[model samples]
Target chain A: MELGPYLILASLEGAVTAAVLALTAVGLSLVFGVMRVVNIAHGEFFMLGAVIAWWIAHSMGGHPALGFAVALVVAPLVVGAIAVAADMTILKRLDYDPERTIVATIGLLYIIQQLTLMTYGPEARPVEAPFNTRLAIPWFENGENGWQMIWPWGLGTTSYKLAVIGAAMTVLLGVWVLMKRTRIGLVMRATQTDREMALAFGIPVERIYALVFGLGAALAALAAVLIVPIQQAHYLMGGDPLLLSFIVVIIGGLGSLPGTVLAAILIGLSDGIISVFFSPTLAKILATLLVGLVLVFKPGGLTGSSGK
Target chain B: MSAKAKIIALHGGLLVLLFALQFVLPAYHHGNLARIMVLASYAIGYNILFGYTGLLSLGHALFFAAGMYGMGLGIQHLGLSVAPALLAGIAAGAVVSAALALLALRTVGVAFMIVTLMFAQAGYLTVLYFGEYTRGDEGFVIQQAQRMLWGIDLSDATNRYFAALILFATCLAVSLWLVRHPFGKTLVAIRENEERVRMLGYDIFVHKLVAMIVSGTLSAAAGAAYGLLFGYAGASFASVQYSIFPLLWVLLGGAGTILGPFIGTLFMFYLIDLSSGLTSAYMLIAGVVLVLLTLFAPQGLVGELRNRIWRWLP
Candidate 1:
């Protein structure tokens, strides 16, 4: 009821959003950085992940946890395979020209969306969380009882939400390790730095690109799978994630992975917090305008990295 | 025939054909053609910046919506007549585009696209936020009584067709004149090589700004005219889908070609119209066409024609 508890509640909501956004934006950042091409269908991959998770969870005749576990592993792989196919078939043929890639990805976005609408049938479907236990959060206040912890009504979150945050962090850490401590990452980075040089070094640049594209899409799908329980899977649900992650990727200085995560958190938190004080639509308008102004004034982004 | 005479004849003949089609066509196709001509005008406006000047804006819908609302609001709230309301719509578009150009022009390439997209997104949200006035997505319709231009009742089918034709022809002629003029050549040259154009003592920023304004104004005129002719103003016209529509039309028709927008609009309109008769998933066809075009016919229908048969095609 009090402002402090309400703020805490909003922050908790914000954390969940930030967790999902970081994954999605990081995925976009990776593709944008490495391939130097914007994948407009990135959000479609996210939607596909959510939809596939729903399908798997719905079809599997088992405990919700078992279905969720299977979906967690399967959705990303399926989406990743699709991404690789698309990359090989379309983007590769175009030689990854920036403008053409954008146009092609837009076409991919339409196809993916239309197919989903056809099969998914334009309804929002919810995936049952593996587990949900409302845990009340304690708040401290300086009252007559002096620095006492008190349980506040409606100041709680589901166990599943907390697990999502934890899962996202673990996956993000894994991605960081893969990028920094793996030979594949080295080859990818080398290709990103200089394609011709990477080719000279026998890096098999095209295969690396395919791998990177798949990985990026897999990351987006993973985020969608994690969030699908909290948010329903729908055909049109991809648009917001696409726009928000796009803003995050740009604000995070394009290909900088850390910057993408940081920007995602910043945007995600602000979006939640702003909704508390203003109409949600107004908050969206302000955020969109803010991103436009930022791009206008600081095209290099807040991290000051002129992304290649 | 001389090349100049041939170019004139081609454009003139197309306009004449469009004008004559109104007499013999059935009602359904006739109405679709009128709507197509208005949308083609929007695409032509889009081409001025994208095809000719190499500035690919993802937010032309903002200008289009601005005009629609500008005219709609003027009539609804301010009680202005049709002609003044139309001018008001165009003015709104000019101002909005000018302001957006100032901010958006600072960024180039992908950044520019993102900026325009963001602003347009914001514009769409703003429309939703102010739902009391603009009616948001549900939209408000202009009354038939107000849909009169001078002594002519524009609500009549024949008058509407002629009005659309007049608008389309004006846009076409303007486009034709711009392309033939040195200013239009400069825009084409800038599209080819911005650095070289700048080196040749041209103020690239001003040129781009002007192109943006002209493009925005024309799009707004279409939006205004659409609301007036069709008797409705809706937020959907200001949406991302609307922004992409012009891009798709220009791309499919042949960007930078004078007649490309009309051909693209006509082809796309019919493609959707005819296909929607069979199935509701016409967008699937649209998606496939876009991908196939990028793969095989990157130059588009008119572009291919120009490359293969009409080297003198504008």
Candidate 2:
């Protein structure tokens, strides 16, 4: 009812958007970081994850949570494998020439999107969340009782939405640790820093590329699986994620993970708040405009290093 | 035959074929031919930038759409004739694209592509934002009263066909001239190596800027003609799909070659048209063709032909 409570609600909603968007965008940023390739099909992989989640959940015929959990584990791996295959077949064959690969990935995007369209049909399908509990949020009111806690009417949120935020953060943390602490991450870093030297150092550079590409797709798929319950799965759902991912990646600086997460939160939070208060179309228009301006003014991104 | 003579013969033969076909073909078939001509012209404009200049822009749809809307609105609101409306559309497209190119060309490689894509998308939203006038996703049709152009009824299918043919021919000839010109050679050189061109003291930015404006203007002009002839222009015309259409056409036909866009457009249009009724997997063909072409045949049909036989095409 009050402005404070409404703003808080909007931020909470925005956090959910940021959480999913970070996972998707961080993947895009990471792929560009290591592979030097903008994986245009990245969003299609996200779309695939949602579609797969729906299929697995629908077919399992078990408790919704069980299906969701199984999907959580299965979707990313499946999507990751697909990405690896694409990297090998399409990207490697092109020798990863930056321009050629963009076209190749565009081809990949259409291939994956059309395949899903043919198999999944044109309709949007809802995925039942494992748990659906409405938790009413209380807002503090200064009354005779002195700062009494009052349950805000119609301001309750589902438990599942909150879980998505927690889950995405946890996954993002895991990714951070995996990248910083793991040996595989070191190899990827080495390759990014200098590919020929990495190869000379006995690191299987090509193999690491496969892993990184797969990792990017897996993250996108994981984000998709997480949000499919909130938003229905559709064949044509990849476009927005792709567009938003580009916007985030550009504004955050292409290869900077921290910058990406920060930018995602910035964009996702604003998008949610704006969509809630204003029109979604306006939100999209502003976001796209912001990206164009950022690209023109700050070619390296807001926090990204220069000379990119 | 001399390469120049061969080129002229090819152009002359194609022009005659198009002119003669409209009379024999049914009205529906004639309309399809007009679409091919206009879209091929669009692809030619795209080829000038991507094929000749070595810039791969994914945002040409914004320019194309600007033309469509500019012409539609000019005729409706400004009460202009078709010729001036088309010019207004071309000017709108050229200005918008030139401004956008100035900003987008600051970044190279993937950044440039993304910037263009974002700007095009922004343009699409802007069109939607003014949905009242545009009808947004529903699109706007040119409802202006048809007038005579040189004593010919403009609304007649035959007249529209001839007009489109003339537009396509002019664009093709201009593009041929540009590609053969020393200025066009500098673009090819830049595409080959920007650093070397820079070392040679040529202004790469100015050349690229001009190339982009020319490309955008041509695409936009074709778009204006398309809208006027088809009698409608919608937000979809300004969409990513239209942008990709030109890329696909140029890639499949031949990027640098003058007739590559035309060949690619005809081949693709027929393939998609024939396959659309048979299967829902029409786009799959396009995707596969693009992937295969990028991987195996980067030179395209005309480029490949030049690589082997038909060396006189230029």
Candidate 3:
């Protein structure tokens, strides 16, 4: 591969990876903001989303985009509704005991994983890319010399992958605007910052928590829908990304949107570059260690307290 | 002297029974029994920090790993005999615990748990990264017989079981003693109210750090025993899942009590084994049980059962 074409490919990969990571990190941050419970099962929601999308595609005669679109909407609702139910039933009883809640959610994670195993079996389900045409640019071509990069950059993704990335960015932007500019967003921020004060100010803190948690679940589902194309759907795929996204949230500063975004991109790029240079497993180790170093040196995180 | 006499009598009776069982039981079952004893011992180490001190470290596996690897490394690299190898593992575990305690003790509550977890993961990754030296996931074997004192070789399953039982009983007694001591009282004070403990002139951080190091050291000793029994050491020894097993054992048995973790580990493993035998959906069943336990009885099986029994009696 020529340097220019490789650079373009690398950048595109960076963009897609960053988008997926940002989507993952945001949901975790949101839930932490509202409920004070770090939902260890959040990655299961992401995994379930991918599984749901794959199932939809399989059932709908292999229209992956339709599957993607369906998952984008339905996956989050299904997972969020389950989480909402959990919130109302088990988590609600725990109140704000984050430790007990952590234990409970870990138990939930295993339950979901085992259920997935029973339902889907232990095999990884392969997901086909919905769209197949690469956006190609005319380059210098020779039979013996092989094709070479020339001038104008030709960026390409199947219309499906492009659509997924586009949709994800739109959802993220919409969430940012919603949190920054809306009335409920204001309440969420206020509650996340201080629940007692918010309650004293006449806010229905319980409802806000449930809503925020549901919203976070939806975001994770969105990520799962988009991410299905990159990796096969599997019951245990959630474990790795769950650990990685947690590192992202911690390094990005807890509940800081901009920080999460920046940290996500940083982690995404590092993961991609490291995987390319070394083994994928080593990349994971490096990425985590980098986060730990940041944590030990700067406990407040990179962007340090984006308000609450 | 009377209390000491009672302890000696009880200890002698237990040793006599253990010796008798060795002759009656099949050799393999005795080995299996030894394995369970080692695991229960490991759980006890976990309970020392989690149950009594109220520190929820999700990375106790690190100490265990340290012990296992310390023995493996000592045997492989230093050509050390069994007793020295085990001692090396204990020493390594102590060093790791002391180092980790310094950073982890700075934070309290859930943050401390997360930090410890991160460190454990980091430790796992670090080991996996140096795959060449640590044999990575392939694991290393300790080929030597553990050192014998006088003429008693500990490599034999029955002898190992007796050694493990003795070590376990000794550690358990020490832990119980520590819990009753002035220092133990200070830890309880810190657990109940750290701010008040600080007000009363006790350095909460120092006490917590000490407790963590001591607990980790015992966990390390158990890890060494685990390595000796299994004869292999791998990264799985330091896995996140291994960390959770002890945490669950403590949670299910009840924290802040002697004999809780031992009972909890035995019950949990047996419940799991039985469930697996009954159906493949055992994990789901176990998960449900775990969730129910957390939601309904935070005090755990023993603690909850004791309360109910007391109520009935009253």
Best by TM-score: 1
Structural similarity to truth (TM-score) of each candidate:
0.98, 0.97, 0.90
For model 3, residues A15-51, the per-residue Cα lDDT tens digits are 6777888998899999986778988888888888888
Maximum-lDDT candidate? 1
Rank by DockQ, descending?
2, 1, 3
Say which prediction, candidate 1 or candidate 2, comes out ahead on TM-score.
1
- Candidate 3: stretches off by over 4 Å: A1-8, A136-161, A305-308, B1-29, B144-155, B278-286, B305-314
Shares of reference contacts reproduced by the candidates, in order, are: 0.72, 0.74, 0.41
Using Cα atoms, each model's DockQ against the true complex is 0.77, 0.78, 0.49
Q: Determine which window of 10 residues in candidate 1 chain A has minimal summed lDDT.
A: A299-308
Two-way lDDT contest, 2 vs 3, winner: 2
* Local error of candidate 3 at residue A280 (angstroms): 3.2
Candidate order (TM-score): 1, 2, 3
Docking class of 2: medium
lDDT head-to-head 1 vs 3, winner:
1
RMSD per candidate (Å) reads 1.2, 1.6, 3.9
lDDT of 2: 0.90
